[model samples]
Target chain A: MRKILDKLGFTNTNTERKTVTFGDASVVSAPGGRGWTWLSVGFFIILWCLASIFEWINPIFWPPIGAVWEQFVFIFTEGYRNFTLLEHIGLSLYRVLMGFFIGCLVGIPLGFALALSRVMNRLFDPIVEFFRPMPPLALIPLVILWLGIGESAKIFLLFLAAVWIMALATRSGALATKISKIHAAYTLNANKKQILFRVILPNALPEIFTGMRVCMGVCWGTVVAAELVAAEAGVGMMIMVASKFLSTDIVVLGIILIGVVAYAIDVVMRYLEAKLIPWRGKS
Target chain B: MSGLSVRDVSMIYNLPNGEDVEALKHLSFELEPGELLTVLGPSGCGKTTLLNILAGFLAPSSGKIDFDGKEVLSPDPQRGMVFQQGALFEWLSVEQNVGFGPKMMGRKPNEIKAIVDKWLSIVGLADFGKKAIYELSGGMQQRVALARCLANEPDLILMDEPLGALDALTREKMQGLILKLWKETGKTIALITHSVEEALILGNRVFIMAPRPGRLIKEYSLPFAEQGLEKNTREIKKQPDFIEVREEILTMIWDMEEEIMGRQEGNNA
Candidate 1:
């Protein structure tokens, strides 16, 4: 029965197993693990197909996978609301990148100031602590009120999302520098400027990269949500418009696209981090 | 006056609860140029505090430190320090780390490279200069630290349990390298260690401290360091005189630890 089950693919027969013993006591067999990510995704798609075929959910609420695919193809070829799908993605990415870059530009210096100088920390720490906890989405109404419902408003919202996180991350990074490293540098005849630029800055980089990754994620999320409330062209606007017209297929497609794009951005950021800061956790 | 001198140096830490902790008290010592001095004591004996003060990372509550006829006020290029571990800058490669002091001093790139190369080879890390600090083992990292400190050509070097993190085999090997560097460079060195044998093997003068006020209790002038420079350190460890001194120091520290333990228990009672 076991052999038959293995032949039927009910068991992972190809996996290699080895028993590892610790000291003179317990031994446990562990299999060489491989990810089954795509398999689980395929299974979910099949389940969705079955649900649609059997009318397990209302078709309007949960459209057939075929309908979503057709919407994707149509948007890819014929365009949507006078802009190509790529154009919409590009416009959204442009806003996120601009806000993220500008936020880091302002926030990283502020973080360094806060960390290095007691006066700066005392002055700005309360303001940062105040805004860091408040969600960027909560500021949408205020941002629109100040800047109006345009690119500036959306970009401003994203900036707000990224700035505080980057600032906090940079501050912690600078503060986390080991005292011995500073002492060693000082004893080696490093002046204050050299210590700040060489020792402190480099020491703070791994933490700053971590902050950047977090900032990117928050900015991506904020851009989508901001577009849902305002903006003429974006993935979130596209989804909102489709939902208003009850075109669930386009809505589903937009949601999936958002998830895939966010995942891709995170993966790229992780790859960059590994390449730039190879000694991150090793020390 | 020509080398390094500590006159009645004392460090008192004021606790938040309005109490005073005397970390070091009336610590007086002198290390001449080319002398290797190793400090040995149990925990809370202010050995680290003394090293820190000598490195100019700390100012004693009262007392004075004079090096090379100058009062030591702050950390200077002339006084280099080596921590036990995690003091290295991981962001820089071994070469960059070794060249840091010179680079900071605005030396030419070529000059810095030459200094780095010379020291890297001295510490036996010549080939590993380009490697990131994290890629190296514990012993290799300490070697880089040593090279980095030596590359600066400091007048004095302060080491705080530099080999404490290494395994027994690596520690022994590093001890030999340290002795070689000391002999060749002729720089005054003050090293702190927990091991009595290490103190005996490394120091021309082994300064022993006692806690409960953290004062110097004993000082021994040993010939083992000079002898080890010529003979094997391991073989020197097996010598009759070396064993005798080791046992004596061990008993001294053991008694101090027991006394501290008794005092703590009495305080509780």
Candidate 2:
């Protein structure tokens, strides 16, 4: 057990440690952390391949890696249903972006109002608080009933997923404006409008960006789920259709696509955040 | 007539439990134009409250402040402030931050740019005009704050321990810069600080206050700041006169703090 622990890099080195304290252990010894990420991913793929080849989990349920790859190529070439795979991806992206943008447009201003004014907060606080905790997926039945199973219902669900998060993020952002900054602005001869626009708005951007990133993630998850419940076309619907026919390879392919797309969106959002708000955590 | 005057200022904060805390009591003082007044006190001495009232950020429950022959009801551009830290806008570039005041007052863009350039050079941050505020060091950030305030050409400057966040060496350097600016601009400055050495080095007039129903207890008119302009502050500190005064004020503050601590311990027992 001691040898195993040593091999696992958990050796009892405390006895041999120097008496003097050093700087942060994590920063001092984050050796090859990025390498570990790649190593874990490589190990998982190898294990999956080995399990499939050895028939550890039945092929029908597990679907070999090659089979999933073949399904991906088939869909990429022949398309899913009447639409191309790209088209399905594009359609989902469109819904998410449209819903997300609209949500931001409306919610950001609402959040500013709620943060800046007592009356607005009192009027909207209960409604926002009530709906904020509710999952957008839980609203599917009502949304479908009201807007039907068309694109509007799906977009509405995505919008719901985004709006509350945006509002909350923006409100906190505005509220987080330092008292000194406002006082500084006022003493600099800035009027109320100038203070709001120049000081408060810029101060709130970092928080608003954080909200956008979180809201995007929630909306991405919600869009897929909404599609699964009612849509005729989407990555989620494609997976649903594939599973009905026991085409586990296509189902696996679809799931992979969803994960990949979601990850790609997040990476893009992070890049944009870095470009726009370089002083975010530094300040 | 052209400087700041505080007449009978008092602040009482009501606690949630229905008790009232007298933050500042019957504080009255006058700050003459071009005079540098440094206020020193132990914690809870209401020095901060007094500074806030002077800046017009907080309204005293009673009493009034008059600046330049006008009743000071709110924060005006003519009275600028420098907080200890984090008052500089991180999102703005150094140039933009310095130019903020003039821009807000609807000055022409060329005039604003000129003001920013002049002040940045004066603060020795001329090369850092386009640099983001967060990219600067703590000391550099304070320089930006000073430049920003000066660009407004405020008749008076209020500072709340502006060098408190800096290292000892940096604090000394900033103290020199502040003295130079005070002599050059000749603007009335009221600075609140906890450092006895600092108050002595910076202020032509020093006001020391006591805690618990906070009010002014003593005032000293000193010549160190004027001497500091021509000689090193370190050399001045070594002088017999400076050392004697420093020791006296240190003991004064130390006794007040000990008394407060003793009272708290007695209450607990």
Candidate 3:
């Protein structure tokens, strides 16, 4: 918090001062306290509710706030399709997590190798370059044809979206390491392994964390698209069915829920990045 | 051979355009044991190139560097270098920075701690051990860098203008500290500097270099650095012999600079 306040260009005064969260990753441009966020959000909801209640916009176009809230409770109490709301969210999270987990576990090491070794970079560079500009949505038709719209297909899409991010992040992080520090380690009689693990890896972590944040955002954006194939129970599937039936309130609810969850994941990532790489950005 | 020996070393840098620039030309010198030698030169005199070769960062195109009678192949704990700036690991605390060498050599944790403590105190940074390297002032950071190198117990300490970035007062204070450390440790020191006063005050044996295929042009055997251990560097500089040597080296370097300038203009023409 002190780091954030200090970073916001606050000067020390003789008078007492309040701590500010200026650069809170979750809270953008928040000057002093969190009151503005809640107040603004409440204001928006009220405006939305009044417009819906007065029929300023068509109910089919933008459903009433109260209607969306009731649908949320209905989804929880009884079930959406067969499983409850929590289960739908849980199943979606599982697929994203499994693919993202495996992709990172394999891709990060490969990225390290690509950055560290000329041979590995040469071998993998063309492939990463070729696939980099293509979005995961472009592969959906092929994924469905190959994996038959199963859970594997969705997970694979998420993995394909995320793996390249991790690889490139690691490569950049390794490149940003200072040659002077490496030479300092060498003069200390450090072997190749010691320099690689101790000197190179720690310096690479901040960039890797940046990569992870981006990967998670990409995964969330693509999760809904991936689940559009034939997911049994997910927010994406719920939105798809509701839109088809013109259940506009449920569609709004699903979109809002996805956004809220993605924001929550990003906030958690900011906290972890702060903890693991406290030395980041200072040097 | 008992100290460090550089036998007729030369270096050539092949630029991307298929042109070769001679950075160093047949540079030969020896650093006797416990000698404080300062290599003084103009900007393009290849002082850094000489230090890099001595520290085993680069192999000379033509000659050999022998440290304690062994041919230099790569950086070793026995040959420690302090870079001009940003030498210490920014991530490590001062204590960990000093302990890094021993840690890499797989010393026991307690032994590393002991060495860290000893060098930290010697460098007057005992209280700063827990502090991060970035938090220190430039002078303090250089002290930590020196402590870090000395923690490895190197026989030769190569300082590539270690105090070049400091203010005048801090440079003077650090020069005093260098003399004190040289007296205390009896380690062979090869200090590179563009400041003639610094070279005269800290070096018992000084090598003056000329640029454009950099090579040693003159050498001086002086008593000021030895006297600096007991007297003030300012007072030592007041001596007639010290004044004479300063003027002589100053004129030599001025001539070299003019010659290099003429060559540059010629190239332009």
Candidate 4:
């Protein structure tokens, strides 16, 4: 195994190995158990234990860590045998991704339009400003009225939440393009369309990516809100059902799942940003 | 039928609060073919305004910019400009930035490649073709900007203090390259600079302007027109008239400073 690991380029000759119980042997490092992550987990466990034994507080309101884990296992196995946690998570992810992509399709060009043309700015600025300030969740009732309680209404709500952020970011980014660069482009005899595509759009990509991140966060938050009203099979629906039954462990488990998923999406987006904007970070 | 002609050009800025500021007043100059004309002045002297008009980037409120007896209305590849900040596209590789002009003009890939390669060699950035703009030093970026402009094969090149951002050493190096390019290409060049020495060093004819409603004060022609100062800067410094001309230009600028200060004081009173 050690030889195979070395051949596969996993060898770390600098480290010393130590054998431990539970039939596990591992390399020992001085920094082990000294990181903030370990301390944070230890504190979380202590808090969970203390909160569980208080007894003065209702158990339904604050479940113990073990209880939450147990509920998570139950939901994965017997409790949700018909429809697993993964199924709910998959549905939620689909909704967010679909809405987010739709927002990008509409938002990026609209933002460029706002930057490039005064006529478009005048025509759309008032409507955009009015809608931009209102919360996307607030439009849920109107959306449902217009499109009914189907996937369309929920998707529309998510798109509405994400689009404004993307548009505003793109417009600002386009406007921030250096005049000198534009003049240089002009002197090169670049046509209007060429200048817009080659110079303006690529320069705005970094800012556009920033807007996409904010839009994603908003999309995630609004997905829960959209599901809260009438979702049949989503994480938000699971939490709402657990709330009514006073199942604190299930509620905690759902909340943890949502947080973890959101964190993972955020990490992925950050990685994408680093890859796409390699030039921006270098300077 | 001059290479470039500023035919009694004037510019007026209508301020947001309904006030009017006259930036340029009857600015007229003519560039003979293959002449390097440098304009020198204090800040707000419309040095840039004059260059912009000639480059067709801006329209004068009065008078006209004419090129080869035709009225210049808009920017064209025939009159290329190199800006002070390099103005390189950060996203493009060095070759792409240099090749941008030809590509946009719909030149064939082979033709564009030839032009890009030729200018890149002249600027001494031949090996940095695939590198990103941000990867280059300030001096290298400026050289790329030069290469980008030159690749278009412009009849008249307008530069707005193109080497102002460089350190003294880099600026001197760039000055050398500019003189070499001027000699080899023989392109009609109009460069705007605040540095009197820079104006004196590069220009065949130097036009010194007065600040605030900028108008040309005087034009001086250098005696050593064919001599390359980049190579013989020390010998030029040793010349009898070089120090005298430098001091004369310096006094002209100091007088403008006093006039501006006096105006400011009167406004306070």
Candidate 5:
């Protein structure tokens, strides 16, 4: 143990106590960024190629990875401009953003109100809980009947997807704040508004951020579902159109596109999480 | 007139199954201005329960607690609490956490900054203002908690085993810090602790309590005074009288713990 500690550069006199350093695992930290990606992607390609050669399945049901790759390249270049994919993607992004914003606008305050006030929690609890478990996809027929097949229908569905998750997250966040902290604030002679904004909001940030991340994922799924219904363009619409003609390559490409886009967005959210909570990974 | 008073306070907590649990049995105590009163007891002796009532987080089943002759119906800024776990917001940097009370009080930016700076320096976190609460060690986090509460400049400071979670060295360091703070601020303090040594070290007058239906068992006045006593904390430990009082209180708590445990076993049987 002494030899290992010496090799690891450990010493005592309580000198150099101000900062502690530890060994880093560069392979774990930066695995996917370098040559490791080639290995993973290569394995995926081999698996896909073997599965495609099976004689039992329809050719269109499981197209070759090469076919899908060819279509992916075509979609990215000449075919994408003519096929209205860009416009569809833009419309989908806009609808999701609008719905997400509106949901947050309502959910954050309602959550605070629910957690802070017993009366509000009692009154809204039943109604919120009733709607909470129902999948937003299940509400589509009614939504279309009420709002029609235009932007409102899609936005409304996305809002339903985002709002409840946000509200529930906020409520839990608010309630979990330590009473000692509140007492500290009160003793400081802080008023009600101050207690809520300064103490409650700041304490609830990490939870709220977590909720927002979850809600964004839900919104992405909701957008796809929304576009699938009576939609002219969007990633989901692209997939829906491809499915009609049994164009397996387009379907595969569309599915990959959605996965890639969502994954990219998730990466951004993770980056923000890291920046916002620098101490998180240390422990 | 006393700076704070607790007159015949009785707190009863109702269990979810509708059973009544007596937390504080008509407990009453008073503190003069700038006085430091430390309350000590065994676990489950309602030491923290009493602190919570004083902080106005819970209402007593009957009786009232007063600060500056005003009844404490609910929590107010005039009686700030430092919790055992520090309870600093993980999201807020040290500067924001310290400034929280003043900000809530609607102090201007300049005023908030000045108070935060002063308290941060007092707690020896002057350079750590931008550091997030989670970035701090348990000791540093508690220091930030102390700074945050002190920045409110409350007439009374209520602490519930504020250094309980810290290691021995940290706890001792914190005991010293509390004495230093009491000397500099001259704020009335009511601290609840399980450690008899801690009670002896920090309090001008130590209030010892018995277990279960937790009632005040004894109050001991120190031979040494609290004012201008920062340098004397370590020296006071060496005082024969201090050790005697600590031993006496320890024996009382040990007896109460045995009695409580026996009673609990009887209920189980």
Candidate 6:
């Protein structure tokens, strides 16, 4: 156990022995953590290949990784349903972007205003709290009924999903700008406008960035659900379409694509958040 | 007429529990231009409350404060303040924080630069102008705070225990630097501290306040601040009068604090 722990970099000769704990699973060390993650994935793939090769599980029911890879290539090359994979990805991205952009544009300004003014916060807080808990999927039928299956209904649904997240984040950020900072600015002869823009806004950027990341994540999810409302193209639509034909491989492919794209977006947002607000919690 | 005049300035706060808490009571004083006045008191003596009133951040419940015979009703560029700790805008670079006062006053860029450079250099943070506030030590930050306040060229500057957070050596050094600046700039300064050494060493006119209904309990005039400029702190402190005065004031404050404790205990009984 000590040797294994030493090998995993969790302990050395100079330090006290300790168990490496990851949630409920305790191990000797975490040098194994990275290896374990890859090992598990590799193990699952090997099992899948063995099962498919031996006809242990019917290929139709549980396709091998090779089959899924082949289907993924096919979808990339021959297109899926009425739209190409690229086109499907692009369309979904555009709708989500548009909705997220609108949410930031409208919600951020409103949020800053709400944060600054107690009266405005009092007035809108109840309404915002009411809508914030609501899922975009729950609003689909009403949105579709009101605006039909056009792009407007879907876009609005995505907007509704994202706006509250961003607005709440922005509100919290602005409201939480340190009271001492405000006092400092005031004592420096800063008027109300200077205090609001210079002191309050810069300090609030980190929280707003956090809000945007959360808002983007929600927008991605909501766009997929919104695509369920009579959309011809989208990764969400591809998943829906493939599942209808029991094309489990295609469904798996679509889900993977969505996950990869969302992960990529999260990486970009994290990078931007760091670059834009380098002093976020440094102070 | 050129200096500040506080007449019968009092503050009364009605607590939520149907109790009237008088933070300050008819505190009247005159601060001559270019003179440094330090108020020394125990905790809860409304030292800070009085500073806040003088800053125009708080309106006196009664009476008035006049700066050059102008009613001081609100915070103005001519009245700058230095807080004890974490008052410097940590997000801003040292230069930005120092220049903030001039920038707010709509001074020309060149003028603001000159003022910022002068004050920053005066506070011995000449090389640290590009550094962030968080990058500085406690002493350096207070130096920056002092420079930031002085940059405004405020007719009067208020400091609330500005060196209270510094180490003893740093605090002593800062005291001398403050005196140098006071002599150089000739700005009226109203400072609050709990240190008898600090109050005696800095103020030509010193006032001590009583706890509870915070009133001016005692006042003194001394040549120590001037002597401090020409002599070493130890030399000045070695004087028999200095020792006697320090002990006298300490005893007064100790007695007041004990009285507060006794009353609390009596209530508990």
True contacts kept of each: 0.93, 0.93, 0.73, 0.84, 0.76, 0.58
Interface RMSD of every predicted model, in angstroms: 0.7, 0.7, 1.2, 1.5, 2.9, 1.5
| Per-residue lDDT of candidate 4, residues A1-283 (tens digit) | 9776545444545444533434434443333333445557779788878877775457777887778888888777764525788888888888998899999999889999999999999988997898888899888889988998787888888889888888888999899888889999999989888889988998898999999988888899899878888777788888888888898888889889999999899999999998888876543
Q: Rank the candidates by TM-score, best first.
A: 1, 2, 3, 6, 4, 5
Off by over 4 Å in 3: A1-42, B234-244
Q: What part of the reference interface contacts, as a 0 to 1 fraction, does candidate 4 reproduce?
A: 0.84
Which residue pairs show backbone clashes in model 2? none
- Candidate 5's error at A276, in angstroms? 4.1
* Candidate closer to the true structure by DockQ (higher is better), 2 or 4: 2
Question: Which candidate number would show the highest DockQ if scored against the true structure?
Answer: 1
Specify the CAPRI tier of model 4.
medium
Q: What is the interface RMSD of candidate 4, in Å?
A: 1.5
Lowest summed lDDT window (length 10), candidate 1 chain A: A24-33
Can you tell me the CAPRI class of model 3?
medium
Cα lDDT, model 2, residue A52:
75
- Return the lDDT, model 6, position A189: 83
lDDT of 5 by residue, B1-269 (tens): 55989889887888999998887898888899998998998877788888888888888899888889899888888888888775776667899888877877779999999999999999999999998787788999899999988888889999988989999988878888888888888899999888788888888888988765878878888745463274556677788887888788778878887888899899999
Q: Write the per-residue lDDT of candidate 3 for residues A121-145, one digit (tens) a residue.
A: 9999999888767799999999999
For A10-85, candidate 2 gives per-residue lDDT tens digits of: 4445433645436647444644335455668889899989987887887678899988888888888999888789
The per-model DockQ list reads 0.89, 0.83, 0.69, 0.56, 0.49, 0.60
Is model 6 an incorrect, acceptable, medium or high docking prediction? medium
Output the lDDT of residue B144, model 6.
Answer: 91
Arranged by lDDT, best first: 1, 2, 3, 6, 4, 5
Q: All candidates' TM-scores?
A: 0.93, 0.93, 0.91, 0.90, 0.86, 0.90
Give the distance in Å from residue B185's predicted Cα in candidate 3 to where it truly belongs. 1.1
lDDT of 1: 0.91
Please give, for residues B1-269, the per-residue lDDT of candidate 3 as tens digits.
58999999999999999998888999888889999999999998888989989989999999998999999988888999887777777778889989999998889999999999999999999888999877889999999989989998899999999999999989999999999999999999999999999999999999998877888889989999999999988788899999999999999989988998999899999
What lDDT score is found at residue B190 in candidate 6?
Answer: 92
Indicate which candidate wins on lDDT: 1
Query: Which portions of model 1 show Cα errors greater than 4 Å?
Result: A1-35, A50-57
